[model samples]
Target: MTDPADMIVPLLREMRAENLEQHEQTRALVRALDKRLGGVEDAQKSYRQALTADTLLSKLVTGEFEERIEALENKVRELEGHK
Candidate 1:
């Protein structure tokens, strides 16, 4: 009494619907992952800039100390030579 053709049509329709649903879900997941990856990249860039700035600041402080010591030593030598 059952018609094989009729059964086949309904099965095909169900498969099509399931395929479309899965495709949409995959697209949404890709969009979300892309957004999260962008955020992570931005954060990593900021961290690198902070590290570079800290290194430059440390070098400047060290240079300042060396300059001051050299100037002080020159003044002491000049005073001894005058006396």
Candidate 2:
């Protein structure tokens, strides 16, 4: 009969090889996930920049409209005083 310890060596070698292969696959998956996460982060930054620009433009336009309305109201008050 074959020695049991001699058989165990080959089995251990096979398990070690399989474990190495699985470790490489896990590393590849993590790299792919990291790449995808970078893309998502870039998109979020672009969206945030666009939102900030839009908010600034809205505030400026609103300020100009308010100024024009105030001027018109002052003119109406001046005309009433003349009458």
Candidate 3:
């Protein structure tokens, strides 16, 4: 019969190698996840900046349009007074 010690040694070595391989695979997956999350965070920041710019532009347009309407109304009133 073959020695039990010889069989056990090879099995233990294979198990250690498998464990190392699995650890490396897990680390690689974590790195990939970190990169994807970083990209998502950058996109969110860009979207926020765009939203702020749009809000400011909308306010400016509304204020300018209101002022123009008021000026036109005043002109119409003056014309009626002169008639």
Clashes of each: 0, 0, 0
**Runs with alpha carbons beyond 4 Å of true place in candidate 3:** 81-83
Cα error of candidate 1 at position 30, Å: 1.3
- Relative to the true structure, candidate 3 has a C-alpha RMSD (angstroms) of 2.2
Per-residue CA lDDT of model 1 for 1-83, tens digit only, reads: 88898799899999999999999999999999999999999999999999999999999999999999999999999999999
Per-model lDDT: 0.98, 0.99, 0.99
Q: Which stretches of candidate 1 lie over 4 Å from their true place?
A: 79-83
lDDT of 3 by residue, 1-83 (tens): 98998899899999999999999999999999999999999999999999999999999999999999999999999999999
By TM-score, the best candidate is 2
- Clash-forming residue pairs, model 1: none
> Can you rank all candidates by lDDT, best first?
2, 3, 1
By TM-score, how accurate is candidate 1? 0.79
Q: What does candidate 3 score on TM?
A: 0.73
